[model samples]
Target: MFNKKYTIVKNEEVIPGHRLMCLNAPEIASRAAPGQFLHLRCGDGQDPILRRPLSIHFADRGRVYILYRIAGRGTSRLALMARGDIVDVMGPLGRGFTLPAPGERVAVVGGGIGAAPLFFLLKKIGKIYGKKKDMVRVFLGASTLAMVPGAAQIRKMGFPLDIAADDGSGDFKGTVVDMFRKEAKNLALDRVYACGPPPMIRALAGAVGPDPAVEVSVEERMGCGVGACLSCACKVRAGEGEGFGYARVCTDGPVFDLRKLVL
Candidate 1:
């Protein structure tokens, strides 16, 4: 969890309104895990006072990748940065997804930009589980065909992948949760990891019922990346007791058990 200014090695648009920024930060990269994020200071200005939090898209060698959507002032500032520019970042923060034991049937779900981290997760699994990679399947969704995440890479890796697009532009023309529900009826998945819109997350929770096999990487805004501030609080089941308790997403998790989440 280092906080420092890192040099931007590359910044390219993967699609309109979305940019992929790479930083030369070996320290953070080496420690990065799937589902972890970085707090990036968008610019030198004081407007938008808080730094924007972006998920770690990919990390390799000495480079860390950030895939972000340019939706507002913070992200807009990030978009203006070019290769060789310096960016302030605090990273590898929060708990990441847990890996499955060998021979376990695994499924990963990602929606829209949330798929960023899942790509890194899948890449690692594909590498570590090579011959047994066949046990893993992936579901990805986006608003359009152009927005779908990691389809090409997933396909090339020979993993079974199902893509759903809201605009009916992919192999499946429906919500990703719906696609998973339809197909998951037959296969008994040992562990499922997901990250996406709240509605999608909630729907997935409902679809899976009481199964604790589902783990979700939540998307929330942060005040202090290290969890000192009380921002990014999430609701989760408080066990046999009466009510729900608040969990700090920045520290307790960004990833949580679906059965334990309050939705």
Candidate 2:
């Protein structure tokens, strides 16, 4: 991990309340992998002392992008930042998703803002697979059409995109998981990756049921963004015992096997 001040190359609103910010940070960007995230300081002063962790939306040669929604003071302040503004950040922290092997059929499922990290995963998969033969499927879900960000860009990539809006504002009128269930039999999926709210993850875990191929990126409130704080702890089923054990999301995961997670 690296701690550096990155210049905001681009900062714009992607949707109604969401913003996508690109930062110039070659070191971090180069090392970043899909499902990893960055911890941003929002401001220089101590106003918002703790850094906010955001998933790495996409990373290129010398830049990293973060997609976030303005939900609180830290994000609201971050939204005010203009192009060329600098922000303190530390990352490409946490374990990321494992890419599927060649000829392996995989499915990526994301919900709402949770879709952010999956973009990087899709890009990496595209580069590795290098075919337009429907080897990968992308599923996105949101409460409404307005809440689904990056739909056009994802669609343009030609990955057999499936979308769902709870209010029937999108192509599929149900939860993203619902869409997945409806299409599961036809896809012949070998592996599955997902990220979203707790409820959605829980439902998905149950649906998949002990399938070790299912990997999920979890969302949790973090403090230090490192192992020291123990601020982002998640429970998982114990190996020998019946109870659960704690794992730090910042270090041990943020990405975990759906069957092992206590969801």
Candidate 3:
């Protein structure tokens, strides 16, 4: 993990309320993995002393991109930042998702802003496994079509996509869990991965059952980005007899095996 200052290379809105910001951080980007995230200080040590954590949407040779929605003061301030601004960024911190092994179909489930981090995963993993037919499938859930990720762009890259919306606004009408339950049989999904709100993650864990091959990304409010402060603790299931314990979402994970998570 590295704590470095990076200049904002560009910031563009991919959709309303959500913007994709890229930073010039070669060291952090070079080692960044999908499902990993960075903690950024908003507006030169203003109120909200804690830095905000954002997942890596995509990382290139010398840049790392983060996709985030403007939800509050911190994010609103972030939205105000110009392209040339510099910010304090620390990452690629925390444990991340385990990539699917070769010859196995990896199914990715994303909801709302949860789709952000999966973009990196899809870009990196798809290039490696997409050559094998039916190797990658993405299921994105949203309130409507406008809220989902770039489905057309994702399909253009040679990955099959499935979309689910609560209001029947786009393709499939229902939650991602419902869509997964319906299409799982025909898709031959070998392993499942997901990142989203707490309720969705809990439901996904139940749906995935005792399967050891499933992985999930968990998000929680954070204080110190590193492990020391114990500010971002999440409850996760331990082994057979260990019951449940608190794991730091900022360090021990942002990712965990489905079977081992307490939900």
Worst 10 residues of 2 by lDDT: 203-212
Error of 2 at 148 (Å): 1.4
- Residue-by-residue lDDT tens digits, candidate 2, 107-165: 89999999999999988888888875388888899999878878887777778888899
lDDT of 3 by residue, 1-263 (tens): 89988999988888889998999999998999999999998878658677999999889999999999999988888898979999899999988888877788778999889988888888878767858736777889998888886677778878888899999986799998778767776666678889989888877876664433787888888988889888889887767776888999998889887777776
lDDT of each: 0.87, 0.89, 0.85
Q: What is the lDDT of residue 37 in candidate 3?
A: 96
**Displacement of the residue 126 alpha carbon in candidate 1, Å:** 1.0
Q: Over 4 Å off in model 1, which ranges?
A: none
C-alpha lDDT (0 to 100) for residue 97 of candidate 2: 95
Alpha carbon deviation, residue 53, candidate 2 (Å):
0.4
Model 1 over residues 119-163: C-alpha lDDT tens digits?
888878888788777789899989888897568888888788888
